[model samples]
Target: MMMVGKPVYGIAKSRSAFAQAMKSQAPQQTLDDLFAAVARQVPEFGGMFLGDNEETLQVYLSVVSPTKVVAVQKAIVAVFGTSVIPKGGVKALQGQYGFLQLKDWYDRMTGPILRVSGVTFTDIAEGRNHLAIGIGKPEVESRVIEQLQKLAIPRESVVIEVSGPIETLTHTVRMPNSMSPWPYLRAGGYILTRLLCNQTGVGISQATLGFNIIGPSLGAGFVTASHATAAWWKLDTIAGFPPADFYQASGYYPPHLVGRETVDPHGFTGGACPTGLICRYSDSAFVRYNSNVKFGVGHIARTTGITTSVTSPILTIDHGGSPSGEFLIVAAPSVPYLTGLTLNKVGHYTGWTQGKIQMTNANFSQIPSAYIQVGCPGGLADPTMPPAGATLLSQYVVGDPTNDVVHSGDSGSPVFRSLKGLALRRAELYGIVWARFAGTYKQFIFSPIGGVPFQPTGVKTDLPPFRYCDASASPPC
Candidate 1:
């Protein structure tokens, strides 16, 4: 990691001024400059990771407050037991570069904005090294812009940032990913798919197969959400699991690392792990089979060379979508659980995906209750594509009306890509889910996503206009 500091040059100065002025005044800041700057600063974004040149890592960030970053850090600590990412901005870092190195900040989720640049600087409390103010160069702006265009996230959803520059900054105003002060979901934790389920008797056969995701825990011993309390893997490795959890709730839940359990304490079985340790969620429930023993952690099955969770991602089923309704279970792909074939849930956001919906002639199920129809945000991937008549709702799935896909109790579950490979955030949503469908599908679903608990902007356009309290009363707080 090299740190270079110099006076801003002519081209750099001009680009910096233009970017700064635009960022300062413009409601939506473009990141073309920030990404390019990082690339010019480091080669990781420039395909250096791929043995390619001139390609700087193209990093795009959706605006987040320092405070929220800290809260998410806490959630990461509380939910996902693993230091999965470095101490500072691991998720953010992954978005910037193609991959992240975990060994550096194993206990925390923090790091520099860009790593490929090999530019390192220690924090200075009173004296220096805190270049949080601005980018010091302009030549880097082009690379940032180029990468931004290449990464292709929504312009309205990004706030461009670059390192090594003082004024080479861009602010891209975006729809808030989290609405509430608390984060919705914490990175990789055991996810649950919470739907109508009668887990007791004859109902188990008629149970509605909900969606979900689950992560391994180091304390919970085995898994939850399964028919049994312990969610032990049926087969080793992710090749068997589906997603993260068996029960999927929508709210904020982090990942947990299960302790390794080596079989023979007296060298009876063989190999290294004789008895594995135990992993648990913040709830203090033991999760996986072995805790201390690290598996053959390898890069995800993408060409990106990113590592993946060696254990199977779990899924949860929502009997009612609550701590009571939720149960954690392993989604071993090879084990076989889901009844229907997973469809391609397409959307524009890299961390966002949608489910293939078949419009029915029955009635607008969501309408007057949970209606997601035409005119929704990111409505259609291809309005002119094959599925012309069917409409894509604003939300990826039907969630609680006040909040959607899920609400207060519905945090921490994976908005899964059961069929897709575990690469690229696996093209999944990585935040809190706080809304549900309030209308019927026969009509259309309109989504109004806010920071965390954002409500529908105008769902009652059909009903009489009425003025009411916008938020829950906090006892006249």
Candidate 2:
């Protein structure tokens, strides 16, 4: 890599004012300008982030081989201009099609059985590059290694660590509802009452709205865990009635449409076990916002208690000085897991809970094939097990065993990371609560947005546009 000594730009008067003015621009906008310019210069960009100082921007360039680093670096400098490319800022990492090679390899080796839980790359004292993997169990790990060997992955090229148990986290919907009392506040993560069940009882369960989605079909609506809305997927009329004066997180009850039930054209049954790793092929559904009803963004609410073992405090969304434009939380792509990153979630049952990401790109075998249901009658394609080595599986696994951070109505609650600290910070959407380990109290599972299938039927909504933060923050943050 060629080192470009720091090139100084002409200093302007009132430096603080200039910096403040720049900060006033939406963070997303700043990211766009930098990345767009960088892409025009070097097309093979993978990802970028704020370095330790939160000012030095590190731009990742995916290279086919180590020898191409200099050429790519030159191209970047030629396009970005000398001063724009921070001194010693460009990282020319070798990977496939602009992604880390091991990242691609982990996706391939795990097949559909294991979601690639987490990935990390580092060079230690000996100066040898080490790739760490958060794999599941020995049974699954052995199978993954066999696949790696077929790809010629020498044992030395990687290190594997057991993540959470290899077994699938229990799907919350598949279990019995706790029938917890509904809260007064309506928000993204809460229990929506009176789902008519085919069984002998009215379905009383919990769910969360992952985010608001807008497309051509209707001006706006929200998406939630597919299984949470599974009962309504194939039917139009809700057989049971909700409590009078009842409203949902969206501030409206189910519409009276005769034949319109929640649909999941991409439910678990679709094929090869559609789960959260890929949103398009996920266990999620969309509920069109009923224009006739009034709604408000009440903000996600939860209890401040750590778990049932401790006393709880009522918790609600903490508004901060930062003005979160348009969306409070935006989608993030799946990547290797970082051990100690703190994650926050607000749900109808748990209220407010903070935990660490135990695994990423995790896989679960417990998806009962019977639960699969595509949106259309005949279904998109005959459901089948996805072939091994398919490149599209990524999701999250909350490995903590004691917190019970989520519960019955928690499915679909937004999973996010606060920008600064937990008190009051802008959050980057990571995934949505989907499942958990049956007997475990704290373990939770989520679907990563990056793996969400792109381009579904119905009026199309463009992938949320990328906005730049002044600090070089990018999407999939």
Candidate 3:
């Protein structure tokens, strides 16, 4: 929960920082001097807030110096979403504070043109002006009028507009003292980026946009990796560019778990969503993550049978594999209530990462397609939706078995069904990933749709079978 570049502080600590900022040089220092003093309080990342002090008072006045007006305006805008009236800032002049009439308040907020909000220019002359301000996160119009009312000038000169309960607040509420709240800060969310990446089948997230060029047609998708977890930028650069990159987007859905909560006594976990099935209904695109993608050339290490058990929780890729990593998935079986199973969702590199398993059992009948989708997290190869107990090999045209074993960027990855190895069926060598290639290896890569070229020669690194199947999650043989 740590903010990338912000200090952790309680209200009291923050107040201390502000007070410390006030102790510098002289009370009547220049605006630049004021900013510098407040900056010292931050001590790190330029402590982006400020407080009221004699120097702050002086600097506040100096803001009228024209050079500092815009600076003040910018800061004020950040906190309340707009600047104060021309009559002056908090230091300019103070006489009265109250609820001004709505029409006058509205006028001040909207201006004669009735356009921009949360900004004002008040030059009160006489009488009492009662203006009631709105509550938190007020409308732009209300924000501006609220500042003017805080001046507390006489009632005759001002009136105000309140959107809801008409809470009677003093014109001048405590401003950020510094710009803690600004419009620019709440611009993006991590989950959205992650979803966009996965849904589009691309390999990049939205958090990394600053580092990557997000032109149109680049699409929105990303591939995941345990290798380059935190240091993903290197991979990003290597993949060229992934549009709309975002970072450290973390989220999880417990309802999606299997056997534990939603499952029945017989071992059937009711229907659930597949982790990696991108629908054509979505306007998604593809992406590339360089090192982030491990050319998962490995296998499962343990033995498994289709059975329901609570004595022990299933170990995911954590099961014993080999001296090197290989593909060994937890095969699932068809049951009335349970449609899917879960895995450890982590990497345990043990075997040779790139060896073939000539399926000694070779039986995929009782396996449910639901489990297969889970194996590929957010991916499902239903192609034309076959009936129950149908083996996937029956669904596709097999190409080269030797070449099908591994490919580039497929490292530390698992090709599975039911979120495990048993359901995983390596694509026929040179088979299509269902994605098309717009460009060629010889030329620049075009995005959106492109062909998945066959595993080129030489790029292949020979290794033994690393797969280890969990005897626990596999179907009853």
Best model number under TM-score: 2
- Assess every candidate by TM-score: 0.18, 0.51, 0.17
lDDT of 1 by residue, 1-477 (tens): 011001001111232342232222112111222223433433333111100111221122223345534444443333222221222232322223211111112111112222112111111100111111112244544543444355443233223323231110000001111323322221122222211111111110100111221222122222121111111211111222122222211222212222221110001111211112111101111123333323211101111111111121112212242222111111211100011112121110111222221111000011011111222122221011111111111122221212112211222223333323322222212112222222221111111111011112322111111111111211100
Compare candidates 1 and 2 on TM-score and give the better one. Answer: 2
Model 3 per-residue lDDT tens digits across residues 87-154: 23323212232112222343343222122232111111111212222121235545444454664433
Candidate 1 stretches greater than 4 Å from native: 1-403, 420-477
Q: What is the lDDT of candidate 1?
A: 0.19
What's the TM for model 1? Answer: 0.18
Question: Where is the poorest 10-residue window by lDDT in model 3?
Answer: 1-10
lDDT values for all models? 0.19, 0.39, 0.20
Cα lDDT for residue 222, candidate 3:
31
TM-score of predicted structure 3: 0.17
Candidate 3, residue 82: Cα displacement in angstroms equals 80
**TM-score pick, better of 1 and 3:** 1
Instruction: Give the true-structure RMSD of model 2.
Output: 11.2
Error of 3 at 237 (Å): 17
Best of the candidates, lDDT: 2
